[model samples]
Target: MLTFFALVHQEDDSAYGVQFPDVAGCFSAADDMEQVIRNASEALALHLEDGDLPAPRSLAEIKKDEDVAAELAHGAFLIAVPLISFTGRSKKANITMDAGLLQAIDDTASARDLTRSAYLASLARRDISG
Candidate 1:
């Protein structure tokens, strides 16, 4: 897993803006803080979809940059965003779990009109990103 540091800024009446110093031209925005991490991850994935992945700088290194330091001096902040890679391929997996839990998962998946695999994958993605 690769994690990149995102610089976030918000003015008095605007949405939160995100920028990745390591990946040029990759950015994201969210109306609130709760969506920042998820939006940043999606933006990064889309930005690198057809390009080579850039190596991420360590948190220490990023915090040392003059521009980043200046931003931090202001009200801006930083967040670690995980980059989840997708290969566009699927393979079957066999696993064991409690029957009752499996039934609940099935019910939830059905209610959301998603397959069991899809629901599980969504949960995994959220967990990994957070």
Candidate 2:
């Protein structure tokens, strides 16, 4: 699933309501900030599951919350939330292999009736996790 950053602002003087601009119809609020954050998580989860928002960022985006919130006081607080990027992480890691590693991979793939890439991927899962 993808995630997206949103600028949720208070829409009224009472500050009881919040609205996510980047996300249409995505509004979550509570009597307090704690509840608001929890509700926002649920709302964000639903929004992402519904595939309404864009892909989220791996790294947190820079935003000015206090100033933006003041600017949007008539609405909701302008918050910079770290969203889950559906595209996943972009960082790369280096791995070492022997000269005959490719040949061994081919042999394993053929034995399992799988592609070399698939075999390697499974190997990676096992090696990394188990």
Candidate 3:
């Protein structure tokens, strides 16, 4: 699963917080940035579940949002989150390949001008969507 990073800025007073970009809505204090992040994630997850996804605006659009600028001026930390990637992250998974298979993977790597590890990784993710 591909997860994006979320940067958070916490206020010393813990009163009134703001989220990054124009994507996540601004948050009022009563909670710290961590709480804000948690809430934002929950809200995002709920939105995704309901299929009420927001159109992903480019970074430029985000830069032009006055609300975002105001929030940033308040020392809000940039927090990136894996909105689309969360669904595929399984809590636990294990893969066991036999030695012969490993060797075959290495051979395939040699044939493809890629390292064995790279070959195995590509094999694992051959069908993954971008």
Residue-level lDDT for 97 in candidate 3: 88
Looking at candidate 1, the ten consecutive residues that score lowest on lDDT are 121-130
What TM-score does structure 1 among the candidates reach?
Answer: 0.94
For candidate 3, write residues 18-125 as lDDT tens digits.
343434553333264435545555444544564545565555666566766666687755555445334544454466889998788888899999976667655544
Per-residue lDDT tens digits of candidate 2, residues 1-130? Answer: 2334455544445444545545667776667555555556556656666475554433233134454446456543445443432343444556578859878888989999998767876665334321
- Clash totals for all models, in order? 0, 7, 5
Badly placed stretches (over 4 Å) of model 2 are 1-3, 8-15, 55-75, 84-130
- Clash pairs for candidate 1: none
Model 3 has an lDDT value of 0.52
Error of 2 at 46 (Å): 0.9
Clashing pairs in 3: 5-80, 6-79, 6-80, 7-79, 16-29
For model 2, the local distance difference test gives 0.54
Q: After superposition, how far is residue 36 of candidate 1 from its true place, in Å?
A: 0.7
Provide the RMSD of all predictions against the true structure, rounded to 1 decimal.
1.1, 12.1, 11.0
- For model 1, residues 54-123, the per-residue Cα lDDT tens digits are 9999999999999999999998999999998777999899979999999999999999999999999999
Candidate closest to the true structure, highest TM-score:
1
